[model samples]
Target: MDGPPPLPLREQKMNSEEKSFLLPKGPSRLPVSGLRLKRPASDENEPPKVDRKRARGPLDPTKRGGPVTAAPCFPKPPPAAPGLRSHRQAAGSRRTVAAAAPKPAAAPAAAGGGEKKRAPWDLKGQVSDLRAKVGIYKEKAQGLAGENEALRQRLNQLEGELKQATARNQQLEGQNSALALELQTCQAQATESLQRVEQLVEQEQQLQETIKSQSQTIRELESAGRKAREAKEDLAAQLEAREAELRLAQESLAQRAQENEALAARKAQLEQKLHESEMERRSLHNAVQELKGNIRVFCRVRPLLSSEKEAQKPGMSHLRFPPDDSKSLVLSKAEESHVGRERKEDIVYEFNFDQVFPPSSSQEEVFEEISLLVQSALDGYHVCIFAYGQTGSGKTYTMEGPDCQDPSTAGMIPRAVQQIFRKAREMEAKGWKYHFTANFLEIYNESLRDLLVLRPERGSELEIRRVSQCTEELHVPNLCYVPVASEHEVLKLLQRAKANRSVAKTNLNERSSRSHSLFQLRIEGHNANRELHTSSVLSLVDLAGSERLDKSLSTGDRLKETQAINSSLSNLGLVITALSNKEAHVPYRNSKLTYLLQNSLGGNSKMLMFVNISPSEENFAESLNSLRFARKVNECVIGTASNRK
Candidate 1:
């Protein structure tokens, strides 16, 4: 062992301790290890005398110094590293020897060994042991590095998974946003649809009400239309019925025309036979020439009444007569006065027939003496039947006959119609169509008025007046005569004329005509083939009764009427007397009475007179005057006679 050839660990341990003793601890270790270590102590905490860097690193656990910096766990004298001596080998030889000198001989050899000889062996063993420990630390550091790498990989994978989860959350949020929008839109649409539905429901209800009203109205209209159609059908049926009646009338007209033709043919044949007979009968010509016209005259013979019966009979008979609706009348003193005076009279027969003839007369008799005169008129002759007598002589009766206002007597007017109709039927065709127009007029104070158109309330206003034919100022104004077909119609006219007459009672006669009444029938007849176009004028004159002013105690309107009557009667007598003598100055225009009698008194007219007289001696002078006037009228030779066979 020759002084233990310098042990490597012991040598270093010795050198290091000596150097650390020589120098201070500093940045040398850190600079060598390439670490920028933290400063061990702050500047203010270190002792002023001490080197701060050296003191801080040597004692601090945070900053190791010298050999400790490189190997912190290396024992200063690491006890006995593994199986080797601890301090003896690692420590310097100088330190080892010095330290052994102080130790006991026996203990020092067993633990530390001899300083120079044992150091080599101890150094070898400690070096080996430190190498083994360093190898163990390297293994631990490798394990830690592996664990760090594994943790880093795990962190990267977890971060990647978290990013994907974040992206998924964002996508889910987007989907939720879209779904919410769609839901909102759908909800809005549904709301709108619901509102629309509500509106539709309301409209439907309104339509239903309207339809109900319309249906009801339509029903009513249909009913009305049906009714109208039914009415139209009824009207059509009525029209058809009227049309049928018209057709029937046409057929009847045709049949009547045929019958008329047959009658006309028969009449023509009869006329031919008569003409032939006339040719064969030349010997009868002288007889016919001598007879020119057949003058057949009829006269009436009335029974005489005593003076007592005559004066009282008018009152009793008038009282017995029926009341009349046509006229409001009363019996005047003149109506009660007969031709006979109170005790005695001159005229013999009572002749008023107004109370005897009104309604109907026999067709055969027609009248007592007037049928012949009517027949003459029909034969194209002018015939005038004049009534000339005392005041109560029934002059109206003999001319036109009386109305139904007198209940006892049927009038000559009715009889006249019956006779005319009978003769018309017999004559058939002499071209004898008679258009008869009747005019009833009256003359009062030489003035003329229509009698049938009198005011009903005023008897005085109903006075008659005479009218001139060719006068500029007309008096019988606005008088129209209607065609009368039957006897009944003429009778009605007579009644109406009488009802409207004005009568003023005088002592001379009861119911004296205050005015002259004239019923003129202007007949238009065509009969030239049978020698008869005779437009004849038939005048039925009812004169105002003639009376002696001495007998009639006339007063007021009655006196004026009496004067007019006297004047007219005087004029009438003068005209008749003049015509009897064939005088040129006939004085026909002197008064209305004479003017009206122009044709009847003188012209081509045949006249008849009716005389009613009293048997009593008191009326003798008046009766004689009337008779003499009548006789003068009869003697008038106005013209040659025109009569019919």
Candidate 2:
């Protein structure tokens, strides 16, 4: 029932312009035709054909009028004239509807309001209005046609732009899909990077711990290095101090060395003077002994044995020693006189000697008196000491010591050997060197035998012979001359000789040396500093005891042994007596004992004799004979002793 509202002014103006463009400005050029009026179709049975053009007045809906009937109010034209008539009819009908339909409704309302209405059948005026209306409608149709054209063009342009937008939107959608995928990939990479970052953080922590420990170790090493440097400096300072002290010590040592050299030189000079003085003193001492007499005799009275003591022997009271004199002894015995009266008389025989040892004297005291004479042998003098007495009188004990010799009771032979060896060592300081050789021999039954030989050849007799024609020195041809180095060696030799010496049991004594035993030590000395050499012999003799055949009750071999011993002893006494009288010719070769002692009894030799006496009345005669012979020997002055240098 309502029409669309009018367009805006800009649209209306456009429409007007379109109308002006579309419609001719001038009047129509065609010949004017008369309006042909036709009857309205009264066919109710057939519907009227509507003029669709007039019903749809403009192509634009906004300009269209109300619905119009297809009722032919205009003329039906011939077929040949279809176009013109149709156009006219369409226009006329549209106008009628436009003008008539509203008028009727208005007419009713007007009538009610008492208003005048135009009658429906005013033909002429209606025609004129319709004509004018037709013209207006035609113009509007033309405008609408133009508007439709313009609208179509605009729609085409918009469709083209929409297609472009659609294509662009599709392209943008594809780009968005790629970006989404890239975003997914980026998210995955970021997640992986986050995980890697976590691992790196853990490694960084471990590295930090390592760095911390290394730093601690470095600090410790630095501390140690600093201490080492300080210690090195201390050591350097100590070394410097030590070097200084060493230098000072070296200087002091040099000074001390020089002083020691000078002292050594002074000591050498003093030692030389001392040696010279010692040599001179030895010369003087020997000279004093020479003046004392070369031949000296000592008397020793043996103590009564245990057997004699138990028996209370009468001879024990017969022997006597002077109270105030150590050099004199007396023998007092009661004797029956047959010529004058039948009464017992006390006969006193007194004797004097160089020295007399009483029964109380020790072997040490006896050796002390003979030690000086023994030393004279080392001083290049020939020295002889012998012990002579009857059987059981201690002659062998005094000369060679007891069978079981003790150091305290060692005889003259062992003591003399020890003294010679000791003095030889002491003389080494004075540049004297001595070599010693020893021989032990015995005169058995007028034959010379080597006591040192354990087993002698049957016919190998020892003979006393001169060493050479140029000198009077004597030696036994077959005697064993043992080179001895020490006193111990000589003592061993003495023991061996003692074991081999001749011994026998006789009526006068159980153990009596049946042969004369002689031990001789030959000393050869050299003084290299003084360019001097000397040779000497020391002869120690233990003579066989002289026993009376009647007293001993000896027969056979014992009687011969006794006779030989007595004869040699008697010759020994004769030689001493001749030397005491200063006879021109001394009978030194009468017996083996005398012949072997030739050099020792001469002027160039020193001699000592020991008369060992038994303090027993049974041996009174033999003891007196020994004492008298020793006294004769003591009184003899052979000569001043000389050294064989």
Candidate 3:
């Protein structure tokens, strides 16, 4: 029987369900099953056929075209009952038979127009074919089940990988952002570095220019240094030549020095000869003064006083200086004649002295005459010079100047002091040194007093004593003997003595010296080169005014002072007169003044007396008395004085 009239051609092919059972799944499905289905060799060249709808299932919006998740497994159908199974099998058989059968076609067969023919039916053949197909389907189904199990395992693995990949991707994204920020920072740093590089490049360029200029300067300096070195060499050569010339000059100087030394020796010899000549001259001069007489006298006539001139008193008409004789003074006094009518007769007296000074004579001119005698004292001769005169006769003014400070008015004492000191200094060049000791004393009321003492104690009398029993030299005990270094020192002593000496007002003179003042300088000299030494004393005496008591308007103390002064004066005159007559016993101890001057008045001494006479006519008799006493002193010839050396 024809199997259900041949099925249509469309029905004869495999259905969609069967095709799906045979096809592979989409790309999302894993082929986890080890079993692979191989296509028939005849289909190798053909493209694979897939169902579009199943390949692109419902997609998740969030996932886009990503993988799809595994589907859930469905429960398998249970085995059918035997009879049903057989019936299903027969149906499937019938389908397969129909599919295997060729399509019916209208052919030239069947000459009978339109007579349909039915093929012969084979039941066993159909059953066999259906069983084989059923077996193939069972095998495919089992493989698909196994593939699904494997696919489930593979899907779990892929899901774990996907999660890991997603975490890694997020981490990479964070790192990328960090790296981008770092890139931005690095870019900013690079920009700053480029700017710094530009500034450094500018500095380097400037430094290069400076180096170039310095290099040129160094080259110029080197050239200058070479020139300076050459100049230094030339200077060195010139210095050497100068040194040679200096050596030659030094040699010449040495020769000249030798010649100068010879000249100096000659000069020394000449100076020695000069010193010898000076000594001879001093000796000759001393001999001359001795011949003139050791005891000498000088007469000085006092100038008329201003009071006499103002009162229109009788002028010094009685006193006259010889017109041609400097050594003589003529005194003429007009006396009344008793027999005639008031006719006055002239009594003329002429006195001669060693030197007579007129009113016009200067102190200097007077000192000049005695300066040589003063020098004799330095030659070891004891010298005594005294001024003897009546009151107000300029006796003090002659011995000591009215103003000792005035060189023009300075008298014999100051002028002699100056000359002594000056000569001492000059003699120092001759290897002579002189030491002087000075003492000033006054005889008041016939009592010895030390004028150099600042304040003399009341009733303290100084006594004259012999310096040694073997010598006639006399000195006053407790007298202040000062060592004098210069003339100024001696002058100061003179001033001090002048202040301390006794002075009193008298009718004859307002400020009459009431005491005899004596200044004595002891000179000791040494000449080392000549091995000579000399010691001598220079005595200067200013005798008290010798005015008669009646003329002096004496009373009480004044009368006593006048008597004492007159006694001392008379004693001095007696001593001179005795010496003149060559009396064996001289009255030296009769008064303090005479005894103290023992050595100076001896034969081994030089003596000078200044007889000062007043020019006033009222004092003519007193002047005459002083002149007579001085003449006696002048006439006495002491023996030749010898030097102490």
Instruction: Tell me, by lDDT, which candidate is best.
Output: 3
| Deviation from native of the Cα of residue 250 in model 3, angstroms | 13
- Per-prediction TM-score, please? 0.44, 0.59, 0.59
Clashing pairs in 3: none
Native-to-model Cα distance after best TM-score fit, residue 614 in candidate 2, in Å:
1.3
Q: Once model 2 is optimally superposed onto the true structure by TM-score, how far is the C-alpha of residue 578 displaced, in angstroms? A: 2.6
Q: List the candidate 3 regions with Cα displacement exceeding 4 Å.
A: 1-268, 311-315, 339-344, 456-460
What's model 1's overall lDDT?
Answer: 0.49
Compared with the true structure, model 3 gives a TM-score of: 0.59
Error of 3 at 599 (Å): 0.8
lDDT (Cα, tens digit) per residue for candidate 1, span 1-645:
255533333333344344323321111111111223232344434343421111001123122111222211222432334345334433543443242121223221222222122132243333333333333323323333333343345345434534543454454456556655755665565566556556655676667857666556556655655665565566557556545544543443453355346445544543543333222222222223112222121122122335546665442322111233211111212322465555442223322221122222222333643554665555544555555556765556555554445433555555656677677654442234676777777787766666666564323333223456573212233564667665567667777878877786677666677888777666666656666455566666666677777778778878788788788778877877777677878887778777766655555566655554443445556655665554455444555654322
- How many residue pairs of model 3 clash at the backbone? 0
lDDT of 1 at 537: 61
Q: Per-residue alpha-carbon lDDT of model 3 for 1-645, expressed as tens digits?
A: 334533321221223123322323321121112332232455434554442221112223222211223333323334445446435544643553343232222111111132222112433223233333233323333433444444355345434534543454454456556655755665565566556556655676677857666556556655655655565566557556545544543443453355346435544543454455456556656766766689999998877778877754565678887676677889988888878688677999989888898898888888888887898988889999999988788989999988537889998899899999998997775678999999988888887788777663645678888889897667776778899899999999989888888898989888999999998999999988778899999999999989786677899999999998999999998888888788999998898888888888878899999999888787889888988888888879878788899
Question: Worst 10-residue stretch by lDDT in candidate 3?
Answer: 103-112
Write the residue-wise lDDT of candidate 2 on 303-364 in tens digits. 88878887675545677776666777889989887785786878999897778888888888
- Give the lowest summed-lDDT range of ten residues in model 2: 24-33
Instruction: Give stretches of model 1 more than 4 Å off.
Output: 1-269, 274-307, 310-366, 397-408, 429-431, 456-477, 528-532, 641-645
